[model samples]
Target chain A: EADIYQTPRYLVIGTGKKITLECSQTMGHDKMYWYQQDPGMELHLIHYSYGVNSTEKGDLSSESTVSRIRTEHFPLTLESARPSHTSQYLCASSGYRNEKLFFGSGTQLSVL
Target chain B: AQTVTQSQPEMSVQEAETVTLSCTYDTSESDYYLFWYKQPPSRQMILVIRQEAYKQQNATENRFSVNFQKAAKSFSLKISDSQLGDAAMYFCAYRSAIRNSNYQLIWGAGTKLIIKP
Candidate 1:
């Protein structure tokens, strides 16, 4: 199993509340990614980081933002939670492009 | 840009039978990688298999194998002697080999496989 961990396995919050999803890995991986998925929907890349201080927006336009201040930590934050933002957020780390990705259990968010 | 597609949103097979999940991709880069990931009800993305586009030979891991047709842009996962444990949502992914890109994986809509006892 990967050393990656995500906080708040399940979360339910009211609309307009700010929330942050925490993801950390002890594997010292340079590549980290965050994907958003709804029930029976395709996984959409929302944010990614190659290394410390490097972040990029993914294919799907996400209002949330991410920061990579350290190699092991990549957190995603939503400024104003909306009902549409309710989905499963997955965090993954990879040591190399050819290597397999280690994914966290994922955070199931619900905005009411 | 690269895109992966899993046309079969759902599939089923009897226990101990063989089942295949289809995947196709579109890319301009000649060098890249393809992968199959399994997400069980537990919601953990597990690596099932991988295939390097540069290699002509298919990749196999015990009960899992890939039928990769490079020319046809087809990469399918075949689970031999399917087991109940194989039931899950399977995703096909593609990664570019370009130097500038950070090896971002393009994912497909998952195919949920049901194993009947």
Candidate 2:
């Protein structure tokens, strides 16, 4: 099993609250990604990072921001949570392009 | 921009039977990669198989295999002797092999596979 981990597998919060989703991998992979998915829906990429100090927005426009200050960590933060932000957030890492990704179990978020 | 599509929203197969899931993608890049990921009841995404666009041969792993038609822009997965553990959501994904590209994955909406014992 991959050593990657995502804290708070599930969370329920109210509107206007600020929250951060944590993702960490012990494999020392240089690439990391974040995706948003709804039940039975396709996953939408929200953010990705090539390495430390490198971050890019994904195909889907999102209100959340991400940071990659350490090779083992990539955390996502929402300035203000909304009901529309309710969804599952998945974290993944890969060694190189076309390489298989190691994904976390995922964090399921619900905003009221 | 690249896009992956899985037309089957859901599928069902009897235990020990064979089943196939379809997928198609749009991309201008000559070199790319396609993948099949399974999300079980635990909701963890697991890699099932992968195929490189430049390769003429298809890819297979254990009971999972892919029928990759590059010119047709199609990549379909076939599961032989499907088991109850195969019940899950399957996603098709695309990624450009270009070094400068985002390397970010493009995903399909996914198909929910049901296995009947």
Candidate 3:
């Protein structure tokens, strides 16, 4: 089983509030990714990390920022949340040299 | 940049029957991987099946199988003896073999699979 985990399964907050979504994996994978998805829509890659201390922006533009201080942890933070940011965020981890992504349970965020 | 396409937005299958979902991609790299993932109401994306471009033999897992045509850039999933538990949003994804851009997954707008019991 995939050991990737995402916290705050669901969140609802007012706009301008700061929020952080936590993601961690116990699988000792080298690569991790953050994706934003709307209900029934395609997934948009927001941020990704190849290893510890390596974080890069994905194809989609996102105001949120991510930090990879540890290999097992990659958390995303939105300094000022907006209603437009309301969506499901998925965390995934892959092996050293492959693209077979193992996904998390996902966190659904709603900014009011 | 590689792109994955799932033209069918929604599909329905009767319990105990079979169904197939279409997926296609565009890529310049010859060695790549194609994946099918299922997302239930719980919102966990589960890997259904996988196919390697260089492998001529198709990939299968239990009742799920993939028809991967490298030349056609087509990868479709066929579920046999469908069950209500199989109902979910199925996403088709692609990744390159090249070292520089292998980390990214090119995703298709998923197809929602509804099972009629």
Second chain TM-score, each model = 0.98, 0.98, 0.97
Per-residue lDDT over B6-92 for candidate 3, one digit per residue giving the tens place of the 0 to 100 score: 999999989999999999999889988899999998867988888888899999999999999888999999999999999999999
Write the candidate numbers in order of decreasing TM-score: 3, 1, 2
Residue-level lDDT tens digits of model 1 in A1-112: 7799998899999999999999999999999999999977778888988899999999899999999999999999999999999899999989966468999999999999
* Number of colliding residue pairs in model 2: 0
lDDT of 2 by residue, A45-87 (tens): 8999989999999879999999999999999999999999999
**Docking outcome class, model 1:** medium
Which pairs, if any, clash in model 3? none
C-alpha lDDT of residue B103 in model 3:
51
DockQ of each: 0.73, 0.78, 0.79
The 10 consecutive residues of candidate 3 chain A with the worst lDDT sum are A93-102
lDDT at B87, model 2: 97
Ranking 2 against 3 by TM-score, winner: 3
Candidate 3 residues A1-112, lDDT tens each? 8899999999999999999999999999889999999999999999999899999999899999999999899999999999999999999999887557889999999999
CAPRI band of model 2? medium
Question: Which runs of model 2 end up more than 4 angstroms from their true locations?
Answer: none
Q: For model 2, state the Cα shift of residue A32 in Å.
A: 0.7
Worst 10 residues of 1 chain B by lDDT: B96-105
Best by DockQ: 3
Off by over 4 Å in 1: none
